[model samples]
Target: MPTSHCAYDTRLLVITLILLRGARAYTWSFKEAPSQCGQSTVAVAGNDGTPPFHILIAPFGPSPLPNGIETRQILDIPFTGNQSEVQFQLTYPTGSQFIAVVSDASGFASGGTGVATMVTNSTDNSCFDATSTVQFDFVFNIFPTVAQVVQCQNLRISTPNFLGIIPGGQSFVIPEGTITTDASTGTGFSYQANLRAGTTFLLMGGDVRGNGTGGSVTYIVALGNNDGSCLSNNSPSSTPGSPAGATSSSSSPSSTSGSSAGGSVPTET
Candidate 1:
């Protein structure tokens, strides 16, 4: 087997070959992002007798990856470890192509964790950006709460590679707080606060397709225009403690004279 350094050099040559030899068009590979399980893992493969690229993250150990994809814009690897605390060790070689996003978030994490893969060129003799290497020392935790006069806190949102918020229309606005970019989701990010009860918010919550997480529900939300309403699942609403009942925080209703028992607003799916 070629030494790990040899593998890195080879991948660099492959990137250059694709650029110079014009192998098809745009270069493509996996888009690494942070996860909820404190780590991310994927098995990257090469064609023919080529030795595949193996990426294992911290927090959760991963296995040799399996490869199968229909497109190049996205690369899907079999990941069986913690999704949070995703970071690459780059055991292959030094002169490889990869990007790492850090600086502020580079050194942060409380509940889960965050990892970002920026675009890195391999022209230099470095596996990662000369400025940033793959790191996984952060532990971020985000909690959705229901408190009156809630203290403003930064919510760590490890935006997914393909998940996104609805554009052109008013993005979701909660009444009590404000939203801003805690960090780049990739294309960018947004924050939300000052939210009122029942305020409909929007976000690209990871991809619906190839989402390996089970018991977790996925949906395509619809938004309305001025005086518009957010679209949601038509499934029957769930009461608290209902079987696998709803657990996401939601805005409450307008002030109306009613018994406190009626105050408990069940979250409709």
Candidate 2:
């Protein structure tokens, strides 16, 4: 009887510890980004009740332990049956590996603390021409809130390889008469950019904090314009030569009334 009681107590202790730890278990993996020049696809799986999470990609290091400079938040991943995948199609300038960290909505509230994985890379500097102009759009669907001023902030753009934030002012803007609203399901905001080809870039869109929620979400996608074809997943070897002086850009939203919430945009200190 004593032995059985001891064993039961141990089991209870273990269960209690696990419960105390909270429900946090996730597995993240990557595959080649759809475009040859773009970054890779990140697939994340949560142990039930992990949906509605936030995944951040940043340069690997200690300074950015939970969240720091060079961090791009891929916001509001929907609850697709305990698993969801997001694809990044940004070109890395020369050498850059992306580190990913995920936090459920609850975890994000207390600061970005959750599961993290090894660095992943999809480097391809020669995606286009350095001198040429490539027009693309940044579309984001951030979580919703009831606050009157539901907005997103800290819209930053950066070069691949985690070099540093682009210095020039925003070369684009959100349309004057566009529909940027806040809905529980999600809200969409669009911005246009005229980036130099062959250069890789990332846009870090943040969620508005004052409005309601925590952590923001954004995605980097290549617009299929007639200027050049959006390259599918292929090896750089397949292409001939690379572009020279490939750079990237970062732009903050002109206004605060955009999407979900907002926070301080991470920049090289």
Candidate 3:
């Protein structure tokens, strides 16, 4: 019978390709909503002999929760324009609430044109010059029992004594979003960078050029580790050399008289 009708049409085309591959199997789940999740590591710095700049990160969710996620994009760390310094990592779940808007506005990603400067903190030109984009609207809980905050001040030196010659010790605040322990606290030249939980450490400082004069400056702070390295206090550092532009040699005196600001500027890679 014609070879049994060509073996029943190859067994009905292998049962219609196994039912179309089980109807294009697809499954995804990320449940744990009670409120309070944490993770935010956004660092952007570029604008020195520019020619390459591109770092865009978008993660939005202002209202609508409970399930139907809206405005989702938890990753987009792109920078090939030459790259000065860029870091991006965001993960906030448990009733989520995010607004991480970092931008280069498409200057150079192997394309053309570039200009940036938005290091927000860690004083060193205090960057905000030739801006592009920078937004961080954070609110994380991460399931109760999560308190890792470091807020140390005294960065007010328009130029004088260069802040007592910069020398703070034991400032280890390493925990850039990933939970860990080994805490430390304030001391010496204004130190206060503690970490108990983890995932939030990027307190880089700068202002290099210490030859002496009114511009004799030197401020350094460090505490950023995820494998890149930079504990800074107990030993283990990197990223500390690129403040440039200091050739005054003589002309010091312009202090509102505010000292105590040292230790914690480690992210120069």
Return the top candidate by TM-score: 2
lDDT of 2 by residue, 1-269 (tens): 01112222322221010111223354444443222245545565445435664444432222221232232222333334444766555432222233233445554311112211222222343553434322212323322212111112212222111111111111111222234454433334433333333322223333232111222322222232423332333201111233111111111111211222122222221
Which sections of candidate 1 miss by over 4 Å?
Answer: 1-72, 80-117, 124-224, 231-269
The TM-score-based order of candidates, best leading, equals 2, 3, 1
lDDT, candidate 1, 122-214, per-residue tens:
222332123332221221212332221111232333333222111111222122233344442312232322222232222222233532111
Clashes of each: 36, 10, 18
Q: 210, model 3: CA deviation in Å?
A: 34
User: In candidate 2, which residue ranges exceed 4 Å CA deviation?
Assistant: 1-24, 32-36, 60-83, 109-269
Once fitted onto the true fold, the runs of candidate 3 whose alpha carbons sit more than 4 angstroms away are 1-49, 58-71, 79-144, 147-269
Model 3 gets an lDDT of 0.22
